[model samples]
Target: MSQTLTSDQKDALQEVTNIAMGQAASTLATILSTFVTISVPRINIPEVSEIGSAISKMVGNGKEVTAVRQSFAGHLRGEAIIIYGQEGCRDLADLMGYDEDIDQSAERELLLDIANVLIGACLNGIADILQTGLTFAPPSIMAERVIINSLIDPTQLTWNNALLVEVNFTLEARNFSCHLVTLMPEDSIERLKQAIDTFMENF
Candidate 1:
C-alpha cells in the first residue's frame, strides 16, 4: 500500500477528477439557481499518518467545522467527506433560500441534502468517466461545530497510502466554502489506474 503513482499517473487522475468535479459543480449550480465554482482538483499521495495534517489544513484554521461522510463501494470503495467552516450551516441555509431562522432539524436536512448532492454527483461523475458502477450509503453527519483535530481517525483505517483528491466549492453570492475529499484505498487506486489506462487507450 506504500506504492506511489508516477507523475503521469497522477496527472491522468487529476484530469479525470477535474472533469468529474466540473460536472458536479454544474449540477449544483443548476439546483441552487446560482453560479457554483470549484477549484482545480488537487491529487496528493501522502503517508497514512500525514493524511490527518492535510485534512486538518483543508478543514480550516482554528475554526469549528462540520463534516459529512458517505461511503461508496463498487469499482472504488472509500469515504467521501465534505467539510464546512464556521457559519457554514447558516450561510448554506441562506443561499438555499431559507429567508428566516432555520431550526435544527431543517439545518440537518439541508446539510444531508448538500452532502448527498456533492458526494453523489462527484462520485457518479467519476464513475461514469471510468465506465464503472458505484453504490453509496446514505451520508451521515460525522461532526458539527467541532474542531478538525477530532473529526477523523487516520490510524483506525487499514490503508497504508491514499489518493486524496480535494475540490473546494464556493457558492456564488455567498461567503461560504466547503472542501470535498475523496479517499480511495491503495487497491482502489489500482482499479482506477486500470480504468484510466483503458480509457486512454480508447480515446
Candidate 2:
C-alpha cells in the first residue's frame, strides 16, 4: 500500500519535526558540553523495499558505523534508529571522557547513551506538541562496525510502507555526527495525520 500526505500535512509534520529535533539537539548539547547542529528534518514515506536504500543515501554507503534501536508505543508507535559513523563514535567517547580504557563494551554504552538522549527528547517533544503520550523501550545496540547499507534488512519488515523522519545531529568541532531515523508504520501514519490535523485546527 502507498502512504501519502497532503501538502499541508507534510508542512505541518515538518514543522513539528523541526521543533522536536531542536529540543533533542539542545539536550544533547548540554550533555556533551558543546554546540549541536541539526539539519532540517527530512520526511519521507517509502515502500519497505526502498527503506534501506533511502537510509543509505542519507548517511552515505560503505562507511563502517554503529547504530542503536529503540521502540516507542502509545498514541504514537514506531522504532527509532540512530546511526553513528566509526569516527563519530571515537569522537563521542573522547568527549564523554571515555578516552582511557575504552573497550568495545564501553563504546556500545556510549552509543546507547547518545541514542537514548536524542530519541527520547525528540519523540517526547513531538508527543507533547501533538497532545499525546509515548512509552519507549530501552535503547539497545542494533549494529556495530557495519556498513550503513547493511544496517537494516527491509525485506524482513512486516509493513509495506512507512513514514520516515530523518534528522542529523553533528558536533562539527568534535567531528561527531549521527542520524536519527524514526519509522512509523502505516496505521500510525494515519493516526499521526489525524493528530496533525487536530493541531492545525487549533492554530
Candidate 3:
C-alpha cells in the first residue's frame, strides 16, 4: 500500500526532521571541532525497485562509498544508512587523529563511530520531538569501498515501497560530507503519520 501524507502532515514532518537534523549537525560539529551544516530534509515515498538508483544519485553516481547501517525499533521503526565518500572517510580519520597509514580495522572503527553518533543523535532528536522512544541496533559496516549504485540490492528488500527521509551533513572546511537515509516501510509509515497527527494536535 502507498503511504499518502497530507500537505500539513508533510510540513509537520519536515519541520521535525529539520530540528532533528540540526541536532545531529550540532553533535557532529562538537565531535569534529568544526562547523557543520545540514541540508533541508527531503522526504519521499519511492518504490523499492527505484531505491538503489535514488540513493545513488543522492550520493553521486559511480562514487565509491563506505556505509554503516543501523536499525531502530519502538514507536518509530526504520533503518538509518549513512553513506561516506572516500575523501569524507579520510577526512574523518584525520579529524579523529588517525595517522595517514591507518589500518583497515581502524578505518572501519572510525566509520562506525561517526555513523553511530550521527544516526543516534538524529533519530533521538526525532523521537524527542514526537515524545516517543526508539532503540537502535549497533551500527555495522554495510559496505566497504563499494560503488553507490551497487550498495543496495532492491530484490533483497521485503517491501515494495518505503517512506524515505534524506538529509546531508557537510563539514565544508574539511570537505567531508555524508548522507543519512532513513527508510520506513508501509506499516511504520502509518504509525508515523498517526504520531505526526497527534503531535500537530498540540500546536
Candidate 4:
C-alpha cells in the first residue's frame, strides 16, 4: 500500500472531504435546530493496524467514548465510525429531544440516530462529488464507553491501508462535540485520483 499521497492528490481529497463535512454540518444543524460548527477536515493515511492508536490520539485522554460503525460501498468502500464522548452523548441526546435522564436504550437510540444522519450525509456528499453510487449497511453500536484502543479490532480490517478523514463537530448551544472518522480503503485512493483528474479537466 502507498504510505503517502502526492501533494495534488492530498489537496483533491481534502477538498472533497471539506465539501462533505460542510454538508454534514448543515444536516446535523438542521436536525438539532442549532448551529453546528466543523473544523477543517484532515486526512491521515495509516496502515490498518495503526488505526486504533490514531483514533486514541484524536479522541484525547480521560474521555470515555461510544462508536457507531457503518459501512458503505460503491466506487469507494469502507466504514464510517462516529465516536462520541460519553458526556457529549448525553448533551446530544438532550438536544435531540430526549429526556435529560438517559437510559441504555435511550442512549443507543440517540447514538444510532445521530450517526445515521452525520455518516449518511457525509458519505452521500462524497459519492455525489465523485459521481459514484453508494449503499450503506444499517449502522450498529460498535462500542459503548470504551477506550479508543478497544473500539476497533484489528482482526476486522478488510483492507491493508486506510484513508482516515477526521472531522470534528461542535454544537455551540449545547457545547457538545464528537469526532467522525471515515475510513476509506486503499482502492479509494486510486478512485479519488481518477475522479480528481476528471474534475480538474472539466473545470
TM-scores, all models, native as reference: 0.86, 0.88, 0.87, 0.86
Tell me how candidate 2 scores on lDDT.
0.80
Q: By how many angstroms RMSD does model 3 differ from the true structure?
A: 2.2
- Which lDDT values do the candidates have, in the order given? 0.77, 0.80, 0.80, 0.77
Tens-digit lDDT track of model 4 for 53-172: 777777775568998999988888888888888888878877777776667897797689889987887778767768888999999998888877677666776655556767777787
Expressed as tens digits, the lDDT of each residue in 1-203 for candidate 2 is: 65678888888888878887788788788877889998888777666678888888878888889889999999878898888888888888887777567888878876788899878877887787668889999999988899998887887765445666767667856556677787877777777778888888988
Tell me, by TM-score, which candidate is best: 2
Q: Ranking by TM-score, best first?
A: 2, 3, 1, 4
Give candidate 2's total backbone clashes. Answer: 0
Q: Where does model 1 exceed 4 Å of error?
A: 1-3, 158-161
Clash count for each candidate, listed in order shown = 0, 0, 0, 0
Cα distance off (Å), candidate 3, residue 123: 1.9
Alpha carbon deviation, residue 64, candidate 4 (Å): 1.4
**lDDT score for residue 78 of model 1:** 88
On residues 19-132, what C-alpha lDDT tens digit does candidate 3 reach at each position? 877877787778678888888888766556678788887789999999999999987787888889988888878777889998889889878888898788777867876688
- Candidates 2 and 3 compared: the better one by TM-score is 2
The 10-residue segment of model 4 with minimum total lDDT is 157-166
Report the error of model 4 at residue 44, Å: 1.6
